[model samples]
Target: MMQSTTGELSLSWSQVAARRLVRHGLDTPAQGARPAEIVRALCGAHAQVVSAAFWSIGLRSASLTSTAVKDALWSEHSLIKTFGPRGTVHLLAAQDLPLWAGALSALPPSHNGQSQEVRLTPEQTDEVVKVIAAALSDTELTIDELSEAVIAATGSWAGELVMPAFNGMWPRWRMALAQAGICGALCFGPNRGSKVTYTNPRRFLPEFAPVEERRALTWLLKSYLSAYGPATPQHFAQWLNAPRSWAKELFNALSAELEPVKVNGSLAWVVAGDSTFPSSLPQSVRLLPYFDAYAVGGQPRELLFPGRATQRALTPSGQAGNYQVLLVDGIVAGVWHQRRSGRRLDITVEAFEQLSATQRRELDEQVERIGAFLNAQPCLTLGPVNVGAHA
Candidate 1:
């Protein structure tokens, strides 16, 4: 076992990776885990690709299936679909909305690379948020329905086609959708015949209110450290898509509660109580779907994406999770893809190196687990996954 010297903990990259896998519930599935519990542990599951998000959560949970995740969202009201860290669609625990919403609300407003004409002024943004809350309160509406409500409530300018979206321009008020989510005015509802619907977040947890900003940010920082710790402020900033300077300042303010550590001889930190790691190094193989939190949140990109993984699993610009990833012992080893048809699922993996016999058995078991989660017959094919990014 590696030992720590006085006054600081020195850890190898393998140790850090192992700790992360354990925290993420990837090393071993948690028995009979609740969907909300799993989502809470990982902070949130990226849900831009809804199937990938379901698989991401189901893979880490022993008995919970994809239906359970949906139940948590629509039936039990235990999980919420919202704009989360990096302003991406995510399924966060409903109980945690106060903290997540408050921390996200504290972020400096992002322009989303929009020009002044495409963006709303601060005052206009505020007005839009107010209108969205009023429109969505105790009711669900499709984008068109909500847009009509917003335009009727505001003015003709709010409905002007300007902001570019897929194949066409979105209405001017659409720019404030994410901002409304951050302000606790919006969340996703069950689809209305393939059309997505939005409703007030308060519909889930009535009496919901954002926590105070400083307390919420502190809670968020510690939560990130607990899940992906021994990391630097820069890692935190990248994960949250917050300003680097702001992240650095927040870390400095909370320095007293952070324990400095040496990860592969580089400086990093963990929450004071979370510096210890398990003795066992991770040996489990995990097939993570696109935008999996473990794939997206792992820090020190080079260490997590060693060798060919950097080329195979990551995007050209160094973003993780654009492609499905094969993880060997908590590090990206290659790429994988799944094609589902009817009740059958075909999985193809492109590993960088040949796997040992035992690892192959584990891989098979992982495939079976996914099949059970999706209620499909599973088949695994080992070969080159000839797919483009985000395929």
Candidate 2:
């Protein structure tokens, strides 16, 4: 139980964790919820690894297979694959793109350190974005095709081999790809053969139009708080990779819509009328994939990554989601990995401490759930995970 402070609702770490698990749809599977609903609930699912993104959604949904998730993205057009929070690839609900696009496009510009020769000026960046948007409108194009179109639309300057990529130098104008996505100019199309493609988001939601920035930010802040609340402005700032000052200002501007409360002596905020947390502690066990939103978005880091999880589960800088996590009773209790061979999936788990029989049984059930999501036979191994982060 939480010790109460005068005139304010007080919460315990356990209560917060339990409430978060419920809000995240992990405590009890949101039975019959569509993939888009799951994605919308989490704000977005990290999709740098497409498979990881599927599992992140699958785990929270009842009996949803990865095929359903793919269908939502490729066939039904219920989800949009694009740059989301922190300028990373994510699977966002198609219906919410207006809000996300507006909020993200409103972010203050960030500095990406590159030599002046390699970097695009603000004007050049705008020009490249306009060209890219024009090139992609109502049509899908591979990166190579888009690159050719961009250089032709702009000039030889846009084609200069400057930005360093893993293989070699990339063309200069390619730097604006994510920015174009942020501005509602483009989104991912289904891959053609082995090549990735980009297209205009308007093809999916023809009525799509970015909501006004202030209104969009208000919606985003409320959604973030609803899913991962009792979080401070710094947490919100870090999650969005936005300026802390800007986040503070936004939080202050919306003070009347928010309620302040103390969680174990630390201050945080929740939606004004939604500050109550569940009284009972949760006992759910889950296998969360890399960059899972629940693992990455939850705040008051020390509480989520208690003791050994700090050393094992999180990156040295304390970033979560670099490694796949094992959750017991709504908190990280171990780490795990999966490898697939033919129709078989092998999972290895490394617990910070021995799990009770019930926890072990629940862990087995969780592994089975993963297998069902992937349509593979599963084998569980209990041992040290020799693999490193994001292996």
Candidate 3:
């Protein structure tokens, strides 16, 4: 019998995380992946990966074919459930959607510190879905058009509806439709001149077949642990917006296949039954997109930022500062910001505290690589912090 050890794992943490992120189309390498290769790998099939990746990698928005988004829908694997985590639209993968939907749905109306007056009724939801479905039966309908159709369907019932009274109702509609196996964004017409159109999942990809909900949930939980294990139940619960009981259940299911490791004096889970060292673990710098999971996934800032400095890096409003990070040795050593003028991209480094000569050199090399990644020439500027510095 063989035991699993961290060193035996053939891949480094950065490589595994990066590869998984890129494979899911959440992060695009400076060198892009081939479209055929991407399709073959089943990239973009998971909605959480897509949404979280989009935020993590700082993509303005993924320019996906409407069809790909649709394939994720209609298959019954994913759903757009209301009152889900963050009270926003998330393209949750099929398997995890039910658990998330169920957990969120079970919460009281005032959960997440939100008001209850804005909640939607089943009848009102049905009316909106019916009208929107009918109006968009043949073509893509924009947000305005969908809203109009929804309002029209209500007719005399419109004034009595809670959705119409609230501005946040659109996301509720989106969530409901997602639960029904419809996913994808409203297509914006060229020149921003035409009305938005609703792109149906069936119309986008004709091959999607609904999968069993239990299987989908199990697979999603497994993927979460595999990619982000060594995490605590609280962390998992937070990320999935699930209850402690639900998260515990899922986490226990994989206990036999996961090993516990100590990270910063705390227990974290890691994949079990594998023994291979990763090919390489290079020190690379990346400008993570806002809302990146590396920053959001775990509960405390110690994983990515120093505990003492977390307050300064993350504002009271929960927004990360403007500085691009220096990911030296897989730990955030300091912050960097770019100033672009004409063909020049000047990068300024702000060390967390102070750097040794060796650390400084490492930082420089990492910045150089970052320059190349951005397709710009590197001009390094080093100095002490100013009272109010602007990047």
Candidate 4:
């Protein structure tokens, strides 16, 4: 019998989470997709819009049109907005939104009262609703069109213009739509300036049904733990951008289903009842897009990549940038990007550090798989290794 190496024996918490995502069909190797495979992997039986979006990007590395992304949103999932831990736009399922929002709401704003002032108030929000209803009821509007209508409805209140002004606007709109019980996106054809139309959530997904708020929250928490567990309250809190108290409460409620594992001396939650590790791992390469959930969703991403390498992957402002990640043996080994010149796809691979001869051969083989997935020929350009070296 072949013995498992110490590295394999001492599985990192990140690998544990990645394995669960794959088993649940939430993630796939970088080998591309067909539309049907995409739908089947994501929709499963639950059939939520968000899961579809997650499935699409996780498997294909493609960003669906707003409509495609929104088609996954459902009222059974709660959507709310508050500056989460990393202070970014995150569209969560409705049932999961309240506790997440409630947790964040309880925290002091990072910038004192000034930051809070920028958020919409109940009255102002009511006006926003009226405008959105009026504009979207009859026709679909682009983000710009919706922004104009909101400005008109609220007499140009700062909140109406807020969505367009901040980079965080999309998540805010998702929150608004979830609150209104109007899930789904108004996708545009070609460009934002082109024709746009509203789509019904039910029409896109017939199986989803709205559930009670409390029940939704419970289900949402379970789903998060199921897909992203082997994590801690801090990881949960960070992922939702909520408070420690809320994270603790959810973890406490989920105690029966979660197994505590000692990782690097810290306790992390793993899915209860599962003891087997994945027997066969994919031998393909993946190019994860910027802001990919796998990188951002995990708390202390060092579990995925080294600290110095992680910093280089993100923007100077600490935001995820548009970088293509290179995955080998189911872990992030390096980063890659493509320069397109009409018909040719010029690929560059930047290793976190020097690759062993075996790793290099594996990378070359994996790149071929990537080429097959994209249906294009790849011209490989190797960049300097930066894993262990200072930048």
Candidate 5:
């Protein structure tokens, strides 16, 4: 008998994808996992684009309706949309907001090196953060109203930054909004007619006490490995937008709980005892939305988006999400676009390689799944595809 001390497992990209897909609740029906579990698995969904957020969760939990996702954020108060990891708007479970806030707050302010034109001073930023929390405790207010409250609290200087912008003239306090969300001072409230609103996160998460900073962040790394494991500290650092040294510190602190694993000849870490792929795997085809967790969370993007898919999915600048992605046999195979008219949803696909007959049939089924998920008639336009184009 051979005793295994070093936890090293040889794994291929497909094997990783199979496990990751199931872990993300994409391999089964909606009942496969609850919304909170789904969000927890991928850390959180990139919800900067609300539609992408809906589809990200929609594609995973086929049974949950758009209305249900919104209800989860509003009526049920199960989901929270706020500025989370990487300093972007994300959707996470309300119960988990405190831990996210703790970890995010542990990092310094994001606007450290920003140009003075848009930067808020330390005192002004602190006042803005404090005012937002106080004004939103029980009442929901639009950004304008919140800005007013912040100005009242911090003086007119807080809103003095003026620039022609898409939304409106942004105030100096706007620069502190991301930090505010991270500090648990504010979370999205219901829409005030056409404007987005904010409220105290404690409204829905009153009992949510933030754990110790190190403990919460360490748990975050643990969860990161559960889904996107066999990934390097560099990957975790990039995902969280923290310093590489900071990430390494956290990994070092959690060394006892992580097992060494080899990913494409390089060393990475996975939570101990979970360094292998599943016993049985199912074939899969998926249409993932912009900044979808699967595409964002999976590591070794060079392997996940090989060859042609790489060029189109990622540009020379390295910015992704030029278009929606098409996943077949657990890899990104192409790109797609969709439009809606009345109750009908029209979709177009651009493939990187020649898809087989069975794959084509499966693509048709995907159309139906998306249709039911959106409560609309799905009409697909299929042809030989060239990855980046919308139609």
Candidate 6:
């Protein structure tokens, strides 16, 4: 469907959320969408905390077990965890890593523009990337081992390279390592103890071919729109950690493939041909994990939440970051956190509004499913936290 500048398809916020639930595979069981399909569908699952991504998949897929998620990453090589959009660790489809990496690598590192912040020297950055690429050529190394390798490779300079971050000194070599993760040279491996190990993506993707910048960005945006469509330029840029101007420029450049749509009376663009959703779709309840793309991807929180909903879910810094959201009828109706003790799991759900009996029943079933995915016996608690309701 095409919409002129003056004429656009109008959609209610509820309609958009319903479409997203369907698109993200939460509305119906996408039986075939394993970790790879599920992550790719959401433009990669936000995985700053890896366990969250595991649950993100289980919530979307009917049969994905905790072991299945790990197997897909380390054994089956179907998924790869790497730094994706916004320079955050995301679990992405291994087959699509090259394109994702190419597009992300094209964007300048977010730290470079930190004006008053002392950053890594360009020479030091280059040396660190080279060392990581060489040391991890066929081997996986935890951050400590990689730090040792960088120190050994670059001598004293590596040790002296440190930057101010989180009110403490962080190894400047980490910047290059992060950049390499964005550029596709490195990805996560199984954790050794409590430390994450890194290895070259070439271990499974030896046939990786470089993608042109525009082509890769185009591919990524289209996929993003497919899953998180009817999104504004600001939403795309914010999701990618790039400036809004870049998003606007890309939209203008790719206008032919774009279609305008109205989002709860506001304007947005979706890839052409996907601008419509059935007027009536399924109402669903889900437990979306921390940073699950579906909860964090789409925007204009005022529409996604009831009054003061964003205030209830935001961090201390006032960002609408999803830590484990409760989705009722595709809107963020509650928030949750989990604790695992051996084979026992405890989940606490903080509902913004009192759930109806039907919704409560669904919540119970969902919690049980989450426990099953983790191979644990689960106990549930539900209540409104102080911030859950502003009234």
Candidate order (TM-score):
1, 2, 5, 6, 4, 3
lDDT of 6 by residue, 1-391 (tens): 2344668987787788888889999997667577898888888887887788888888888777989999998899999988887787888898898898778877755775544345666776777777887888898898878888888888766765456567677675676777888777788888888778999888889887548888998898899899888888889888887889888998999999999888766889889987768577577789877677876786776666665566677664545554567888888787887778899898888988888999899899899889888899999988754434111
Model 1: colliding residue pairs: none
Please, what are the lDDT tens digits per residue for candidate 4 over residues 1-391?
1223432134455457456557434344434443334333221212222332343343453333333333443222222211223344334443333344343333333322324545555565455555565566545466566656655655645333334334554323333433333222221212244543333322333343444545545655555555555668887776655567877887787677766665555567665765355545544445554455555554556656565556656555443323446655545667776555764667788877677788788667655644554455778888943332111
What tens-digit string does per-residue lDDT give for candidate 5 at 149-195? 88988888887865335867777778888888988889888788889
Task: Evaluate model 2: give its TM-score.
Answer: 0.97
**List of clashing residue pairs for candidate 5:** 351-385
- As for TM-score, the candidate ahead, 3 or 5, is 5
Q: What lDDT would each prediction earn against the true structure?
A: 0.91, 0.91, 0.45, 0.48, 0.79, 0.80
Candidate 5 root-mean-square deviation in Å: 2.8
Off by over 4 Å in 5: 1-7, 116-118, 162-169, 279-281, 384-391
Q: In model 6, what lDDT does residue 299 have?
A: 78
RMSD per prediction, one decimal?
A: 1.3, 1.4, 7.8, 7.8, 2.8, 3.0
Predicted candidate 2 versus true structure: per-residue lDDT over 1-391, tens digit per residue: 4446565677888999998998899998878999999998899999999999999999998799999999999999999999999998999999999999999999998756687778888999899888887888779999999999999988999999988889999999988888988888889998999999999998888898999999999999999999999889999999999989999999999999999888887788999999778889878889999999999998888889998999999988888999999999988999998999999999999998899999999999999998999999999999998778873
Q: Candidate 6: list runs displaced more than 4 Å.
A: 1-5, 112-117, 121-124, 165-168, 385-391
Separate clash counts for every candidate: 0, 0, 27, 13, 1, 0
- Which should have the higher lDDT, number 3 or number 4? 4
Alpha-carbon shift of residue 202 in model 4 (angstroms):
5.4
Cα-based RMSD of candidate 1:
1.3
The per-residue C-alpha lDDT of model 6 at residue 169 equals: 72
Best by TM-score: 1
